[model samples]
Target chain A: MDQKRKDSASRSRRRFLTDSTAIIGGAVAAAAAPAGALADDKAPSNGNLPPNVPEWMKAPGADVGSQPYGTPSPFEKNVIRNIPKNQPQYTSSASRTPIQDLDGIITPNGLFYERHHGGIPEIDPAQHRLMIHGLVDKPLVLTVEDVRRFPSQSRIHFLECSGNPSYTAMKGKTASDLVGLVSCGEWTGVPLKILLQEAGIKPGAKWVIAEGADAAAMTRSIPIEKCLDDAMIVYSQNGERLRPAQGYPLRVFLPGFEGNMNIKWVRRLHITDEPVYSREETSKYTDLLPSGKARQFTFYMEAKSIITRPSGTQKIEKGFNEITGIAWSGHGKIAKVDVSVDGGKSWKAATLQEPVLTRALTRFRLPWTWDGSPVVIMSRATDETGYVQPSFEELTKPRGLNSFYHNNAIMRWQIAANGEVTNGNA
Target chain B: MATLKVAFAAAMLSLGMSATASAQTHYGIGRPATAAEIAGWNIDINREGTNLPPGSGNVAHGREVFEAQCSSCHGNKGEGGIGDKLVGGQGTLASAKPIKTVGSYWPYATTLFDYIRRAMPLNAPQSLSNDDVYALSAYLLSLNGIVPDTATLDAKSLAAIKMPNRDGFVADPRPDVKDKRCMKDCKP
Candidate 1:
């Protein structure tokens, strides 16, 4: 099976190269073609190569409902989320999406990154209920049906784990290993504000503690302002029911917040005047500074970007290679991404893909000509708040390497004369 | 007819009182959670001592509970096995190897009780009684030298016991690094 997958991957890679050339050449030719010449030209192939119809053209295709639920093409099996080799335990670990292998903005439900605390719990939707109490005029229990029946809205946003970046243990790992802990999808759900208003929040309520039904009962205390701002109780992903790994029944979706705080398998929310300071916020996700003081409740994931193509482990031929990747910020939409082929010494603004939404991943691409010489390529993102992605040295100087969460430092990829790519900062 | 008019006036006055008291918005969705239902799931503890159950367990009894329920995964002394090491890592947050254990890093003692109660004993979560969770928390705290073997931990004492690193945290002040949108000549 491994060999078969490798063979298919290589075939796709070859086809991609051919298609790129065809596209570039076709663009140039079409621009120069006369308006009448374009419509009258006969296509190269007429159904078949020679005297015989193509097999697909001659045969009857499978009928409808051939696959009740659709799946990605068998040829695209290589595009998947992978659990890193250094994972401490399978029960509580993260599986990263292969960012370099994907395109555009939306992450497929099957390939979205997965972070499990005590493994995925098989929740029965019929029995699932979200209880809201404490500091509320009326304590209420909302079933899955009731939660869904509330007016719903769909918004595209990115979810990134607080521990998205590699730890000090990460020295020579690929860019995918470093920054693959994020995924984007269009989430369909009711705004948390509407729900809170329904519960009639009391005057002194300041924080709302969201708890999951997983074995860990993962909990995080979100400020009332944030909860009422853009938080959602998401039930669907990418136009379909959420995949089990992405929280099948119901989950809290906080736009522009760290992934962990967007609790999955959410079951309970208790409003209070003080932060719960759960184990996650107190012991785990809190950021430690060089002064021996840790920063608590640091929820926002800063602006960051990476060169996914021509990144670590992906080799590119010299000349005419397009450097493309994703940039995002929890604060707002990515304002711009600057690509640097010669490290930070020189940079050029890359083209931002259209329809960039707030708190969502934006794809950036830059066409470059490699000169068969060693060079360092990197991309820096700036969000609407005017926050630029910082270098590793700059980030470590303040917080130090001991800080495990929220490493949005700029990533640099080294390209060798032999067309090989490696991970590094300098 | 006079009694009927008085009754209608009383009803109107009560309705007006209720409207003024609540002054709340209602979307009219979901059922009102019964007290029993709220008690079953409302398991969170804050720094100011809210929602902690009434239970006391000493370090000695906590060791027993830890051995029986937690030892398999967290090691005999909370040193860690498949689970995270609960003791040691004190004063390591600023060092090269920051060991974030229950004793060294956790800011509040209530967090330990809340965590153990909500999710601990890896294989079977929420299986331990509130007393058992308090006991395990006490044992773990004793191992870290924060509590004495004879000391008993109840909701009041637990909330009162200060963590060593309690002062080691500050509110988030972000956008820490500054870099203008310089399109060229960025690197020094």
Candidate 2:
């Protein structure tokens, strides 16, 4: 049944594209017809060409040649996440996706999610220095070049804003959600353990405070175990110098940890014996539980999945469509993603795209047949640990509604009879 | 039939309660944040005087440090400048809109000491000595009308001084009576 629906949908899409191309051809012909008679049309009359072909596209070599540093195309200028500037006190603010425009898990660096407390710091790679002090026997100050000399490893991972839960807090209410807060890319950096080993960590140094250079001087105390295990002091994202907003020069990449712990524009690393209980770790990133005992150091973002397509504002036609979206886990690689069309009462394991990396974004696709009937759709991820993504009710039961961070509830999108999609409660 | 209804209600309540306790009860998932662990990282400072480092400073000493280190962004007199306005905004919170400076807005004085120590000098952080931190705190407080210009602020004096907004902050109360539902026909 799914295959049959996909066949029909493909045919319709092909037909639509063909029709649109033909319309463009007809418009060109019409514009050419009056060229012989009208003086204004005489310019392009020599050839069957349409006027107003954008200047950049007119010449084949107009596009900039190879760039050592890459930037989004001019056509993609409108793809930026609209960040709301409320006050000057804070430096970096949140930018929402033009979800209406994006199609995949890879959010461009320019459009990646930003939740900076202070403005992005301008650090000259040569002048900027990273000091590894405290519990290390040799507290060394390494320049950007000095750090790069160490062995580097590359991995593809997704950095999500901790605020990913804020969108689903209100059930069934569709706002301008997905304003470009998520991005995925290959990050190249030196393993943090290498530096620690080089400095020779002292015994009992279990936690290290990663501090950024922003005005907020944002800081979070991360477990030393995680740092020695898989963390990296990343300097490049997507094979280039990190963008200023995405912690250009240097940032701590904590795989499988919450985004906040992955400090950006990092400048200082103090290896200590205790957690500093910085504001971000103690009072801010913590989740107030229903039990009144706040959940602290809730680091791992659990197995959660969201269907980017057919989400809040996107419109889909009734028929067979490819339901594609991203699933990730801080615990481990996603083992399976189950899709539910009947409000999660029933689920079928969706096909996970190949090359799934540990603690990385895994794209899942399921050929879904959307009947004309009104229906609700959702996806739940089961990680390698056999930990399944809990439903919204399951998550909120113990945590309650007061939580403002680390919300990994099951996201549900309602499809109307007319194919209008709305974010709704699962 | 009455007994059957009671059993059904009990079963429903059990199901509801199970849903609420979904978090995994893993032992040793995280160790208590120990003093040794706290000492490892130099970023945070709590109100309980848990992580205050050794060193002391007087208001006079702090004034000199402020002029040399903090005057560029915070202004020479702490009136406010390129950065946030840190002084003389007291008692404005109740008027029309509160000027949320260190003295007028922040709920705790420890937060001020913590923030300054962790991130200060506008350009160079962690550069100040603990004594400088104490003196800077004293100078800022004096500028904000919290203390006399000559009042020295050391570890002893700093912690005892109460912030005007100390009682302004509230703890989150949730999943309680406000969230409870009362219905005659409802089960537990």
Q: Please report the candidate that would top TM-score against the real structure.
A: 1
Local distance difference test, per candidate? Answer: 0.83, 0.69
TM-score (chain A only) for the predictions, listed in order? 0.86, 0.82
DockQ of each: 0.43, 0.05
Q: What DockQ would you assign to candidate 1?
A: 0.43
The sequence of per-residue lDDT tens digits that candidate 2 reaches over residues B1-188 is: 66675566457436643111211211221113334433555455656555677677778898899888888877898877767688765665444334556776555566667878766764576678888998888888888778898787766678778877555443333211112111123111
Tens-digit lDDT string for candidate 2 (A372-396): 8988887778888777777656667
CAPRI verdict on model 1?
acceptable
What docking grade applies to model 2? incorrect
Q: Show where candidate 2 strays beyond 4 Å.
A: A1-75, A85-92, A97-105, A171-180, B1-112, B116-153, B157-188
When summed lDDT is taken over every stretch of 10 residues in candidate 1 chain A, the lowest stretch is A34-43
Query: lDDT tens digits, residues B1-188, model 1?
Result: 66675566457437643211222345688999999989877888887657899888888989898888888888998899888888999988778777888788888998898888878876788899888888888889999999987888899999999999888899998977786767767762
What is the i-RMS of every prediction? 3.5, 13.8
RMSD of each: 10.3, 15.2
**Candidate 2 at residue B162, lDDT?**
82
